[model samples]
Target: MPELPEVEVIRRGLAPGLLGRRILRLVIGEKRLRRESSPEKFQEWLPGRVILDLERRGKYLLFRLEGGVTLLLHLGMTGRLLLGPGPSPPRPHVHLVLELEGGLDLAFQDVRRFGQALVFPPGAEPDPLAQVGREPFSREVTPEWLAQEARARSRTIKNFLMDGRVLAGIGNIYASEILFAARLHPGMPAGRLSPADWGRVLKETRRILNAAIAKGGTTVSDYLNSRGETGLFQLELSVYGREGEPCRRCGRAVARISQGGRSTFFCPRCQKKK
Candidate 1:
C-alpha cells in the first residue's frame, strides 16, 4: 500500500495536470473497489466540477473540487493512479477514470482491488481521515507529546509507530527504517521509551520521511508516481529489505523479525533493546 510519502508524491505529481481542470466525465469499472462511492453518485457529483487543489491527509488523497465537494482516494496495496493523454489503451483493473477538460485522463488502477475512491458531499467529513492521527511533521508532535501519548501503552514500539491512529502514514516499510535510525529495538515496549529516545525517533522520522518524499518515495512494489515512474528511494534503503546483508553502520548482518505479522528489518548491533 502507498504510505504518506508515496501518496504525497502522487499528490504533487498530479497537481499540475489536474488543478483547474473540470471533470468532463467519469468512467467506473464493472468491478467495484473495496470502498467506493456508487457510480450514480459519482456521475451526479463529479461532472462539471473543477478541481481546485489536491491535498494528502495521512494515506488518503483529497481532491478539493469546486462547490466544496471532496474526492477521496486510498491506494491500497498494488494501486496506482496514472495520468495520460485522452483515450489511452485500457489496462487491467483500471477501476476509475476521471476525464479532464484538457484531453487528459486520470486513471486509478489496482491489481488487488482493495483501494477506495469515494465522493463526499460538501462539508461532509469522510470517515477515512477521521481515524488518522497526527501528521509526523506537525508542530504539535514533539518528543514529550509522543511520550505522553504512549504512556501506559504496552504495544511494541514498532507496532506503535505503525498504528495509523497514533502516527499516521507510517507502514511497515518506514517503521523499520525509522526504528533502525533511532537505534531502538522493534520489540521494545512503547511506554518504556524515554524522552531522549523519543527525541531521536522524532528527529529521524522527519529526516527519513523528508528524504523519502524527495526521492519520490520507496517503491518496494506496486508504487509509482502519477507519471508512472518508479520511486528511487529503494536504492538508498539501509535495513528494510537487507536481511543477512551487512549493516552499513556496524558491518553486522542485518536482521529481520515479525511484528504484527509484518516483516521488520534492522541491524541488531546498531539497534539494541533497552
Candidate 2:
C-alpha cells in the first residue's frame, strides 16, 4: 500500500495535471474498497465540478472539488496513477479514468484491486491525515510530545509508530526504517523507553521522512510516480529490506522478524531489546 510519502508524491505529481482542468468524463471499473462509498456517487457528485485542489490525509488522497466536495482515493498495494498526454496504452487493471478538459485521460490502475474511490459531499468526511497523530514535520510534533505519547502507551515501539491513532502517515516500511535510524528496537515497550530514546526516535523520524520526501519517496516493488518513474529513496534505506545482509551501521547481519504479521528488518546488535 502507498504510505504517507508515496501519497504525498502522488498528490504533488497529480496537482499540475489535474488542477484547473475540468473532469469531462468519469469512469469507474471497480467499486469494492475499504469504505462503502460507490462509484456512481463519485460520478454524481464529481465531474462538472472543477478540481479545486489535491489533498492528502494519512495514506488517502483527497481531491478537493468545487463546493467543498472531496474525492477520496486509497492506493492499496499495487495501485498506480498515470498521467500525461499523447498515445499511452492503458494497463490491464485501469479501474478509474477521468477525462480532462482537453483530451487527457488521467487513469487509476490497480492490479490488486484493493484501492478505494469515494466521494465526500461538503464536510461529510473528515481529513484522515489531519485527524491522526502529530505530523513528524509539524511544529506541534516535538521530541517532548513524542516522549509523552510514548510514556503514556505500553505498546511496542514499532507498533506505536504504526498505529494510526497514535501517529498517522507511518506504515510498516517506514516504522522499520525509523527504528533503524534511531538505533532502537522495534519490539521495545513504549512506556519503558527513556526520554533520550524518545528524542532519538522523534529526531530520526523527521530526518528520514524529510530525506524521503526529497528523494520522491521509496519504491520497493510496485510504487511509481505519476510519470511511471520509480522513486530514489530505496537506495538510501538502512535496514528496510537488507534482511540477512550486513547492517549498514554495524557489521552484524541484519535480521528479519514477523511482528504484527509484517516483516521487519533490524540489526539485533544495533537495536537491542530493552
Candidate 3:
C-alpha cells in the first residue's frame, strides 16, 4: 500500500490538473474495489462538481468538490492513480476513471482490487478519516505526545509505529527506515522508550517522510506518481531491503527480522535493543 509520502506525492502531482476542473462523467469498471461507493451514489455526488482542492490525510487522498462533496481515495497495495489526456488508453484493471472537462482523465488502477474510492455527500464525514492519527509534520506531534500515547502499551516499537490509529500513514517500509534512522531496535517495547528516544524517533520520522516526498516516494513495487513516474527514494534506502548488506554507519551487516508479520530491516550494531 502507498504510505504517507507516496500518497502526498500523488496529491501534489494531481492537484494542479484537478483543481477547478469539473467531473464530466464517471467511467466505472466491471470489477469493484475493496471499498467503493455504489455507482448510483458516485453518479449522484460527483458528476458536474468542480474540484476545489486536493488534500491528503494520512494515506487517503481527499478531493474537495463544489458543494462540499468529498471524493476519498485510498491506493491499496499495487494501486496507481494515473492522470492522462483523454481518451485514456485501454488499460487493464482500471477501477474508476474521472472524466474531466478539459479532456483529462484521472484513472484509479489497482491490480489487486484492494483500493478504495468513495464519495461523501455534503455534511457527511468520511468514516476512514476517523481512524487516521495526527500528521507527522503537524506541530502538535511532539515527543511528549508520542510517549503519552505509547504509555502502558507493550507492543514492539516497530508495531507501535505502524499502527495508523496512533501515528497515521506509516507502513512497513517507512517503519523500518524510521527505526533504523533513530538507532532504535524494532523489537524494543513501545513503553520502554524514553522521552529522548521518542524525540529522536519523531525527528527522524519527519525527516525521512519529507525526504521521501521530495524524492517522489519509495517505489519498491507498484507505487507511481500521477505522471506514471517511479519514485527515486529506493536508491537512498539504508536498511529497508538491504538484508545482509553492510550498514553505512557501523560497517556491520544490516539485519532483517520479522515483527508483527512484517519484515523489519535494521543494523543490529547501530540499533541496539535497550
User: RMSD to native for every prediction?
Assistant: 1.0, 2.1, 1.0
> How well is each residue in 64-128 modelled by candidate 1, as lDDT tens digits?
99999999999999889999997856999999999999899999999898899999999897888
Backbone collision tally, model 3: 0
lDDT tens digits, residue span 213-257, model 2: 777888876888888787455647788888888998878999999
Q: Could you say which candidate leads in lDDT?
A: 3
Candidate 2: the clashing residue pairs are: 57-129
Per-model CA lDDT versus the true structure: 0.90, 0.80, 0.91
Please give the lDDT score at residue 79 for candidate 2. Answer: 86
For model 2, where is the 10-residue window of minimal lDDT? 28-37
Candidates in order, TM-scores: namely 0.98, 0.91, 0.98
- Give the total clashing residue pairs for model 2: 1
TM-score of 1: 0.98
TM-score of candidate 3 versus the correct structure, residues matched by position: 0.98
